[model samples]
Target: MAPKPTSSIRSFASSDRFLAEIATDARRPGYVLAGDESFLYQRCRAGVLAELAPPDQRDFCLHDLDLAEVPIFDVLDRAQTPSLMVPFQVLFVRGLKTLYGRGQKKEEFAAIDAYFRRPNPSALIIFVADHLSIPTDLRRMDMQDKERFERIRETLGDWCGIVELSRVDEGDAARWLAAEAVTRNTQIHPDAARELVDALGADMMLIASEFEKLALYAQGKQLFLIPPQHDQAQPVADIPTPTITLGDVETMVLAAKQRSLYELTDAISAKDRPRALALLHGLLNASDGGEDSAIGHLYMLARTFRQMLIILEKNVRDSRAIWSVLWHGFRMPPFAAEDLIRQARRYKSRADLTRALRLIARADLEIRSSPPDKRLVLERLILALASEPKPAASGSFHQFAIDL
Candidate 1:
């Protein structure tokens, strides 16, 4: 009998839906799963394999070919040839691009194009690429490489069922976390879900792993809140939860509060010199106190000020415009983005933000140069940046603030 026609390309936001449809059902003859997010693709691939055959049967039916090392023709030949004992065979081929670069061998491309036209009835061939799509920046690739990538997509489009498994944004991430918590027989507060999404950024696999830890932690517990001390009958302890809260997130999930980073930025914006210096000191001293610690502080502070400069130059009047810039440019969470927008208004002009970045860069360089007193250099830099400037710039001030 002739094989079934290949299904049209379908996109999945998460692995759960894909597993429910593909893994649990009769396996298709061919699949082309492509994405830049390697971890998500890997998880989906594992799910596919688990449902394809049993552990013992996998040895006989399964074939993994690293196309980086294996020839395309060899992969095709094995996929076409049926296994004697197994009713169905699975061929996993990776690294579709040829050895030299993104371009494909004409012969190999033709071979794959042909196979997709008339795929094997009993074999399930999967072409997986962690970097199937190119970056949106056209300048990053040459004309030849672009054509090569286009050819690859065209070839895959001809025969295989293509699916895009891209990363999720903050809102989607929050919903996914809530659903995940429910599956684990627990619940995550809406605020707490947003907090988790913001803290972890957009790595779904990392989020999944962290969620598992939280699930285990909250397995048999119920959510509770501590009453105000004056209202409380006694001092409350042992906060347990099936419903995870923001406090639970800080204590259990996050190693350090990301909000503190924004708080430090807030202090700098308020132009409260003493408070800014003290906050900077506390930040450097947190986790592990050393020269290396001060180095990251320099980078982070410089980045924050640069962002503030962007906001200042753009004349962002509303939170919506601020969010648009941050979400698109920096992938910053909505809550933090709003906070930054509010703070950016505090800066009078571009020069103020520029001056702050200059001070941070000087401190960063000194830290890297292995100065004897790294802490003193950092403190001096912080004081200079946070403090109001005098009408007449001092010689010592210029000495401390090297020309950037």
Candidate 2:
């Protein structure tokens, strides 16, 4: 009915407008810049401070905070910095949740609560969290994400307005491509632009940056013409004469898919089935052409499984978390810790994995064992592995559960 808000606000204070208001308030310089991601916080701080700060501190205070390690209190408290004569100081407590992860002796929440009470007025205290889940207690905040806009309105009880990023549909993508073409002085074929948007999805930053790059490469080639090197003539006298061609897009797509596939293989070897599956899916979709070579695909899959067997055999004895596979064996995607736990449970024991490996081995052999039918063999192997359940590894295994 009204408008959708981009991020959730656990309280009115979490709203960006209120954050700006905090900067505007000469009376109240101290405020918490807490939000899901530090990106918004950093941007907000920089913009507001640029308006208010004197020339020097403006640049220094905006981004210098070491959010990953600074103890919340050490920054939040009205403590002295190396220099004091400075007119005003802003305390940016970046990545506030990382504090909770420190070991026993370093626990500092009690001190943090105390620091929150008397923050420095001269300094605007801003805390940024990339996601609510970053905080040990913040995950619960997501339930409020759906009702985020309304909740902010209610929570702020009178806080601030959010400059939200709009969610776009297919049609919107088209409109954006046309309007953007004129702005950057580059002509984008509707199809090429749409393809780029869909592949990139809805990340605003990605869309903006990529568009600019496209404009740069597309410069002078307004009609999306083939380059001079190709020796292709203009299809239409009216077509603006593009310096770049769809061929360039095709090449990039192939390169991305190849890298993504190899990455998938690495994930599989780590016994990180979930990451492995995600990488496979990404590779499948990232390319314009699907599965360039069936024999090549089969080879990759077989190698992945073979590597997995080696890691599993050693890990069965070491019994370390599955993640150690990344460091000890081939590296996979940047999988999260929770994914490792979930993927681990699916491998009931080394035997189940061994069985899966055999199917893949046979598939690989089938491909080279004869003339081909390689595509069918590879697909069959994927299905065989896909059929097996990969429950989240609860780290619940006893006596090397290898039924094989």
- Number of the top candidate by TM-score? 1
Q: Which parts of model 1 have CA positions greater than 4 angstroms off?
A: 1-26, 57-60, 84-87, 97-104, 132-153, 217-241, 252-256, 274-384, 388-404
lDDT of each: 0.67, 0.48
Residue 122 CA error for candidate 2 (Å)?
3.0
- Provide the lowest-lDDT 10-residue window in model 1: 1-10
TM-score of each: 0.63, 0.43
Segments in model 2 whose C-alpha atoms lie over 4 Å from true places? 1-23, 26-68, 78-85, 98-121, 131-183, 187-194, 204-209, 220-404
Q: Give the count of colliding residue pairs in each prediction.
A: 0, 18
Candidate 2 clash total? 18
Please give, for residues 1-404, the per-residue lDDT of candidate 1 as tens digits: 11111122112344455555565445456776655666557666677667775678988998888888988888988888878989888887787655336554678778877876777887888877655543324455446656755655676765666655555556666777776676676888888777777777656676777778777766634423554453465645675446777767766663235567778778767767688777766666554657766776776677778778888898887765775565444544445777887888897777677778777877788888998987788778867776765453465643333342
- Model 1 lDDT vs. the true structure? 0.67
- Per-residue CA lDDT of model 2 for 313-402, tens digit only, reads 655332334445546335332222233343434455667666666676666667566634544555455555655444434685532221
User: Relative to the unseen true structure, what is the C-alpha lDDT of residue 309 in candidate 2, on a scale of 0 to 100?
Assistant: 59
Candidate 2 global TM-score: 0.43
